[model samples]
Target: MYQRLITSRHFVPLLAGFGAMLCITALSSLGSAVQSSVWLMAPFGATMVILFGLPESPLAQPRNIIVGHLLTTAIGLSVATLVGVTPWTLGLAVGLAVSLMMLTNTTHPPAGANPLVVMLAGEHWDFLLMPVAAGAILIVVFGVLYHRVISGKQYPKRWF
Candidate 1:
């Protein structure tokens, strides 16, 4: 049974977990060097799962990951700045983010937490550029490389 599990592709998830570990570690290292870069965001863990564990999903696409994080974070920053971080505004931000993601055809579920993260932290505009935009972009890039080199799989069925 143990040998069957090992050789029957049951360890793919474990392999993906290792990939996640490497990716996040690289991000964290860069984030430490770059003061403005916050590559270790909460939602990124979920992003890693989709990227490494299920890279074939549409949500794992580069466009989806980048645009979803950017759009959601923008909405969060806007709502937090203009409407404040009250309960209703928080809901409003997340709703708008989801709706906009659907409208833009970039529906990455993990990015949905951007509003809460932004509102709760009261992040400035730089947050959109650093962790939201840049971190997401690098994550996608890492996912692509990991899939090709380590997992021997195709990723991102589409680019746009």
Candidate 2:
């Protein structure tokens, strides 16, 4: 029974969930003692799902996750500061982010929401550095370590 359970198709998925839990818990705890820091945002939950559960996917690549989040957030912040967040601007921001992500070859879908997050949350320029850049960097680092140490697999199939 134990061997069968270990070899079951669902075993890997269970492991992935466990991995995601650990990574998020670590990220959350590292935030302010009050756990109110932007260190863990909404999109990060989806990011974790991909990072831990589908590390082999191109969208889960470190470059994609980091660059995609940074680019979209920058675009959103710029638009929000300059034009403002009307329905049109919101669509414009997301469209531009998608197009640019495709062009840059860094299309992490979860990051597709960063623009909306920024616009709605009224995040300032500092947001790009804190939760956007810093958080993405830490997530990628932790994913690398987790996959290498726990899964015995190299994450990011390709660094480029």
Candidate 3:
């Protein structure tokens, strides 16, 4: 099973990575042009890796990517606001995000960093919307379109 998984044609990941990076770059440019407060967040880099490089992962699915980031971002922002951004609070936020994500069945691993991002940046509620939620949704949109245009691969094996 492992060998079969590893033996994919080399170009698959390469092409996917290129396309994903292009999409992300475009998103960043758009965000800059619009002068949005928070256009891109750090975690979305990992998101690109999953969405493009490992499109087969359940974490890469539209539902998981969108919900996981949104849910975790909300939890992280809440924790930061409620508990304040101390060492203990940061730890608590990440733990809560992970646990909540697992319980919700929306476990996108990249989202695990959301708490740290929020706490470290000292961000508030708005952080949940722009860079976290909006960015994630855009990535999903790009993934869906990219897969449609690219032949021989079906993205978002399932929607919800």
Highest lDDT against the true fold, candidate: 1
Q: Would you list the C-alpha lDDT of every candidate in the order shown? A: 0.89, 0.87, 0.83
Over 1-160, each residue of candidate 1 has an lDDT whose tens digit, in order, gives 7545633576888878999999999999998898855777899999988888888899999999999999999999999999789999999999999999999999999999999999998899999888778899899889888877777778878888
User: lDDT tens digits, residues 1-160, model 3?
Assistant: 6445444688677777787778779778978788645578888888888888878889899988999999888887888777788888888888988998899889999999988887788888877878777788888888888877762468889989
Count: clashes, candidate 1? 0
In candidate 1, which residue pairs get closer than 3 Å at backbone N, Cα or C atoms, i.e. clash? Answer: none
Cα RMSD for candidates in order = 2.9, 2.3, 4.0
TM-score of model 1 vs. true structure: 0.92
Backbone clash count for every predicted candidate, in the order shown: 0, 0, 0
lDDT of 1 at 76: 95
Instruction: Give a tens-digit lDDT track for model 2, residues 50-159.
Output: 99888999999999999989999999998899999999999999999999999999999998999999999888999999878988999999899988887655797987
Pitting candidate 2 against candidate 3, the one with the higher lDDT is 2
> What is the lDDT for 138 in model 3?
84
